[model samples]
Target: MSYVDGFLLPVPKKNLAAYKKMAAKAGKIWREHGALDYRECAGDDLKTAFGLPYPKLMKLKKGEVPVFSWIMFKSRKHRDTVNAKVMKDPRIQAMCPDPKQMPFDVKRMCYGGFKTLVKA
Candidate 1:
């Protein structure tokens, strides 16, 4: 089974383009460092009647959008190894030129690592 890193964040609509650009670069870096897959999806259908909608789940404010993202690895150890290298990559530094200048509010971002229980 594979390991995964997941992220959920709120980004203002006005910054979506910038955010996408950053994510694309980040995905490339992760891939180069051995990530099996990387995906960053913007919220299109945020409302639902049966459960907590993404907007609500993220406590999104007016004009802010929700983004759900993930990266896959061969296993937990592989994920750690890849991430360690990725953190030190100059590509990552270039991707995030200034943490203080990031597109969205870092305080609102939620992230975690997971051990996949099942895969199809």
Candidate 2:
């Protein structure tokens, strides 16, 4: 079974472009380091009557929108190996020397690792 790392966060509308650029660079690094897949997607239609909407769950501000992302690996061990290299990558360091300077709020970001239960 494959392993995956998921990310969800609220990004200010004004910084969406910058966030996209940063994500693109980060995605490239992950792929180079052997991640099976890397994807970043912004919220399109968040309003809904069923379940907790992302805007509410994330406590999105007036101009903020949710961004969902994931990185796939062959397995948990593979993910660990690739992530270690990505963390040491110079490009990643250059991209965010200080977590405080990230385009979005790191404190508000949600992240988790999951084992694939089903894939078809």
Candidate 3:
């Protein structure tokens, strides 16, 4: 079975474009580094319980937007190995000018290792 690393975060509405750009760059780098899939999705067609909005769960303040994304790997072990290499890849490091300016809050980011149940 495949493994999926899922992420849900709140992106500042004002920084959405900048964030998308950064995500696109990272997605390409991740794919090149052996990710099976790298996907970034903005807030659209989202539905939550009447009292359980996504941003509210993230403790987002006023004016933020939700961005749900994930990266897929062949398996959990593969995910671990590829992530380690991606972190150390020189090409990826070269593109990171300021780690402090990352589009989303690292502390607020949520991720989980999931086992895929079905696939077409």
Candidate 4:
């Protein structure tokens, strides 16, 4: 089964473009290091009729927006290997010397590893 890493964070509303640019660069690096796929999505239509929405999930604050992201790998071992390389890549280090300085609130970001249950 495939493995995945998910991330949900709060980015400042005005930093959307900057966040996308950063994600694109990082995604390319992940792909180069063996990630099968990388996706970054900005929240829209936050109001949900039923359960919790991104805004609520990340506890989005004033002037903030939610970004939902994921990275795919063939398996957990592959993910670990790819991530180790990605972390050491000079480009990534230069891009985020201080995670807190990025366009989003790193401290409040949510992240987790998961094993895919189904695909269709």
> TM-scores of all models?
0.95, 0.98, 0.85, 0.96
TM-score: the better of candidates 3 and 4? 4
lDDT, candidate 4, 5-108, per-residue tens: 99988889899999999999999999999999999988888899999887777777999988889999999999999999999999999999897679888888
lDDT of each: 0.92, 0.96, 0.84, 0.92
lDDT of 1 at 85: 99
- Weakest 10 consecutive residues, lDDT, candidate 1? 91-100
Alpha-carbon runs more than 4 Å astray in model 1: none
Which stretches of candidate 4 lie above 4 Å from their native place? none
Tell me the lDDT of model 4 at 105: 80
C-alpha RMSD of candidate 2: 0.7
lDDT of 2 by residue, 1-120 (tens): 999999999999999999999999999999999999999999998889899999999999999989999999999999999999999999999999898889999999999999999999
Top-scoring candidate (lDDT)? 2
* Per-prediction CA RMSD (Å): 1.0, 0.7, 2.1, 0.9
Mind giving the per-residue lDDT tens digits that candidate 1 earns over 1-120? 999999999989999999999999999999999999999999998668788899877888999999999999999999999999999999887777776799999988999999999787
Candidate 1, lDDT over the whole model = 0.92
**Model 3 lDDT, residue 93, Cα:** 82
lDDT for position 4 in model 2: 98
How many clashing residue pairs appear in each of the predictions shown? Answer: 0, 0, 0, 0
> Which candidate comes out best when scored by TM-score?
2
